[model samples]
Target chain A: MPLVDRVLLGPGPCNPYPEATLALAAPLLGHLDPEFLRILDETCDRLRTVWGTTNRRTLPLSGTGSIGMEAAFVNTVRPGTVVVVGVNGLFGVRMCEVASRYGAEVVRVDHEWGAPIDIRRMLDAHPKPDLVAAVHAETSTGVLSDIGGLAQAVHARDDNALVIADCVTSIAGMPLHIDEWGVDIAYAGTQKCLGVAPGLAPFTFSERAWARRVERPSTWYLDLGLIGDYVSGGAGGGRTYHHTAPTAMIASLHAGLGRILEEGLPAVHARHQAAGAQLQDGLAELGLKLFAADGHRLPQLTTVWVPEGVDSATIRTRLLRDFDIEIGAGAGEYATRVWRIGLMGPNATPARPALILAALRSLLG
Target chain B: MPLVDRVLLGPGPCNPYPEATLALAAPLLGHLDPEFLRILDETCDRLRTVWGTTNRRTLPLSGTGSIGMEAAFVNTVRPGTVVVVGVNGLFGVRMCEVASRYGAEVVRVDHEWGAPIDIRRMLDAHPKPDLVAAVHAETSTGVLSDIGGLAQAVHARDDNALVIADCVTSIAGMPLHIDEWGVDIAYAGTQKCLGVAPGLAPFTFSERAWARRVERPSTWYLDLGLIGDYVSGGAGGGRTYHHTAPTAMIASLHAGLGRILEEGLPAVHARHQAAGAQLQDGLAELGLKLFAADGHRLPQLTTVWVPEGVDSATIRTRLLRDFDIEIGAGAGEYATRVWRIGLMGPNATPARPALILAALRSLLG
Candidate 1:
């Protein structure tokens, strides 16, 4: 295959740090090796700091964020459990789907696509759910839901019920307080805001969430209760033998998290906001309307309206074929109506915005 | 963390080729990037050749081998599906656990922990199951089950029922003909015999397996039907989009597969056989008894009885602490009775056997 270089401005698989890539090439070590355990311990420590949480269960799941979502639902919601999900975008719908698969009686508080979740409606729903789930930053519509407000509303109804949140597109790029916000469980992917290739899912849980997992589910592979026990000295001598973790992926995550700490989380968030604003301004100058409302937009991912005369697929094709740049097409209702351009982690920079605008301007004209 | 070098002779997390690790360090690419799609296509093509099948639905699931096992069960067996699992070792017991998690009525065909699955007993079981699953190479006990004969037995009872096999420790290290062996679906991990690091689970399907997947379960993530649709033009215009794949892991797998091709699969198999024999001979000279019968032992893994006075954990710890070598402790029935030694992928060589034996002799004497 010919060498193809792409300026990744899509939803995920963001540009990785050079050091992160090098870390992936480190010599292979046994998953339970003491050296590798040190890596795991350090990675978990950094994840807790990046996620703004004090939860001890913070660790990387052995699969992608989607599987992390499944693990969260499968472990917490058994058959006959009632789960209330806030559905405004793709990930919200995904949460409802996963909950229902685990036999949860799912209730959805629906909002218009590209809008923040309706917190009032969610609270006023008829039956109190056994679990409340929402997405902090919806990747598809590029909307940042009011996670604090949602968590507050859920706790008001049923304090015992777990509050699950998908931080896939947010986490390191935005403010997430698992403990302060009373979030029982939260999951994030490594690819988007973490500036690493996709593989591992960094997840954390509160004491309440841990209690729920104690009632073991039928699924053995994702039995986080068993996994947590193994990782938390249950395996004996501070070593655990769970599934063979994605070793290289974990190494990359460690490097990425180290870079995140070096840059500092607050500064990283500010950079994302600045880069997002610049891109939004450039898009506006080129006559492109933003799909998400101004105050609710995610700084890491921006969704723009697809003009009527211009085909989304055609535009995306030209961007790749001509400019060697990649962007995300809309999903669900926005399939042909919008496009998602990511300014996440290492790609959140002034140079990327200029590159995207330059290519888009020529194509639009 | 201290830089610790230990030879991995455990069940997995074995030594990976440096080229494969370098491939993992390649620049991050979007999951759907044109270049990445090209890699994905080539990976499927290469995996098809390695699996010795012409099935169009061959692909890698973005999880560990255990998750691949879950995917097979969840997709193939619905609630109340009568599934018969061969139970001769730890992996087989794991199969039953996963099947039961999906609400399958699981029946076990029992055998001694270190023995191959009995074909006649499995055939004589009354009222043949809807799905029959077996482990090709049981890692826990170093027993090689007769997949060819097991497939025949399942077919004799009910040709319509599917046959699933776990080739976790056998795939490229031994001969496996997915089509000729009449296996409907099979999954293998990269770390074991594939000479890649742990992450991706390579899977392939027969036409019958595809038909079962069409009766989609409630699962959206493990739903091969949806994944196949997205990957095979079902999402329209052949533009595949799902979760972000572990791009680096896939790249490593591509490189690992290239190495396998370079060595040639037949030669790789022969090497494993030679290495297994060498280790067995060395163990015999040390007065240690082989756990599995002579003809039924797995070439990639060997289980040996722990002598009366020596603790299995102590010896394993000594190997790691004193010799800088890693080996596995047995599981379940053989937990305190045996130890597992692996000769897999890049670690499957004459030099490793000599090193392992010398270390064991020092510890035992």
Candidate 2:
């Protein structure tokens, strides 16, 4: 099959910013090239700014958001470490699975799949836990949890407990203040609101998180301490070689971040807000009921219940085949009942929502 | 820190093929898109051909070569499992570190850095080791080890023993027969000989290796079983969601592999051999001593001793600044004594070496 143009309105990998798309084709650079190193440093600076942190340990990991999830846990959750995870969606559920892989004594605070995380329940689950984790924007359900509120509650109870936030789908699309929210560790995907392709994970670690990092993580590839040393060269001003940095992906990310910051982060967030509002309001006009809980729905991703008497897969296939628009189907039990439509990064525009809404209207009719 | 085009004559990422570079700019595709899936399947098929393997579990991992090294061991080496590692260079040293982290009882078969692995010594390291491993090409020292001979020796001793090979710097540039040599597990990088920018690791596992895979690997991101399910799908003909695949990097890899296959693998390897020979002869004519052992030096990466009284870093800097050419300086103790140059993929041509040699001559004079 030949490559075809796609209007990616699925959970992520929405159309990247034009600058990022172009940057991918740029000539290859060696990982240790001085020019590439400068680009890398500048890229990390942009990440810190976007994450709303002054963290010195900020750079893109070589893998995607899922690796980010793995690194966050593998570096902090030693054997028998107590971890409280707010499970509101698939990602939250994944946090428990990943945390437990590193022998974390995971305390699951369960909530409805489409509902925002219950902070009170999360706080009450484990006293003086080593880590508390929550997905700021649950991509699976299109629900947005309050990371700031969760952090405030957790820190109030146990100041030493680290707060790790999954900002994979929220960064650059929503209001996020990693430092101010007391989020000790945060990880994000580039393909979502950052308007880049899916390869690199934008990761950060606060001073407290860094100080408390595992001396030697089980997984060598995702070891944050080694990666941090390589990414942010030590006080001696030389990068310790870890792995071959994905140069092209980092270049694209640098370009993508440049596009976002150039447009101004707040303006980027506003655009996504407008696009999501447009999509949700249009879906309502088409007689579709939203799936996520009211008032806590994510602005970048909107989940809607599949109307009764409609074949979900057929409509989705038609939208993709006939309209070149791709929307996401719900996972697990909600597979046939819910649809996830995203308006992220470059795709988060009034025109995109209008185009997708019209495509849906035609297909449903 | 403006982006400037430099002739990447470094150890790896030696200037991507134009086709691969162009493919990176292709429009975004959802990870689950049918077109992308077809492309991915074809890409894996190409990888099997390049790897000389019939392994059903062949696909690109969403990380670099080092992650490939990590995954190969993390999936097989359980606690107290006796594993024999041939440590001649940095990557081999890395394998022992990575394997030991997963609780493997590592037995190191030490070899000189600039020489090929001693297969006899490696076999003698452990009589009944569960896994025997060696690097096919040492990127740091530019030495090529005989993985086929090592596999034959190890399997002769114990057929149940898994033989893992690090083909990171050897894959498309040198002769590799994964199946024919009975290599149970092997992994490679894209940036070296594949003519693609770094990101994905082309990985493969034999039937025996897959059968003995760790049921619950500690690292979720590098879990081959979960990734295999998603890449190859199942008997039900549906791909399970593992993680978001790096679409653009994979596309670039697909294109790079296509370019190589189109040119013919033998032709590509011959080109690399010819270019390397030319560079080595030119360096010898310049009165520089070759570092790697005779007849074992890689036909893609050439390491030579920096001439006496000639500063390695100063010469490298001059080449980059004056001629826009980037070559690698040796790591660790050899940092000031040796220079590593690569003619890989698109840069594996006579003209590239000729240009670099002329630039070096001027600087040395």
Instruction: Please report the candidate that would top DockQ against the real structure.
Output: 2
Worst 10 residues of 2 chain B by lDDT: B1-10
Of the native A-B interface contacts, what share survives in model 2? 0.85
Give the alpha carbon lDDT tens digit for every residue of B1-365 in model 1.
Answer: 44566788998878897778778877777888767778888888889988999988888888888878978888887778888888998889889988887788988888888888887887766476788888999988999989988898778777977889999899898998999889999999999989898998999888888876636565567788777865555745565466778888988898899888888998999999999999998899999999997899987899999998888888888899998899988877677888889999888889999999999888899
What's model 1's lDDT at A279? 95
Candidate 2 lDDT over residue span B110-130, tens digit each: 888998999889888888999
Q: Which stretches of candidate 1 lie over 4 Å from their true place?
A: A235-240, B235-240
CA displacement after TM-score superposition, residue A43 of candidate 1 (Å): 1.7
Predicted chain A of model 2: TM-score relative to the true chain A? 0.99
Number of the predicted model whose TM-score against the real structure is largest: 2
Runs in model 2 lying further than 4 Å from the true structure? none
DockQ for each of the predicted structures, in order? Answer: 0.67, 0.88
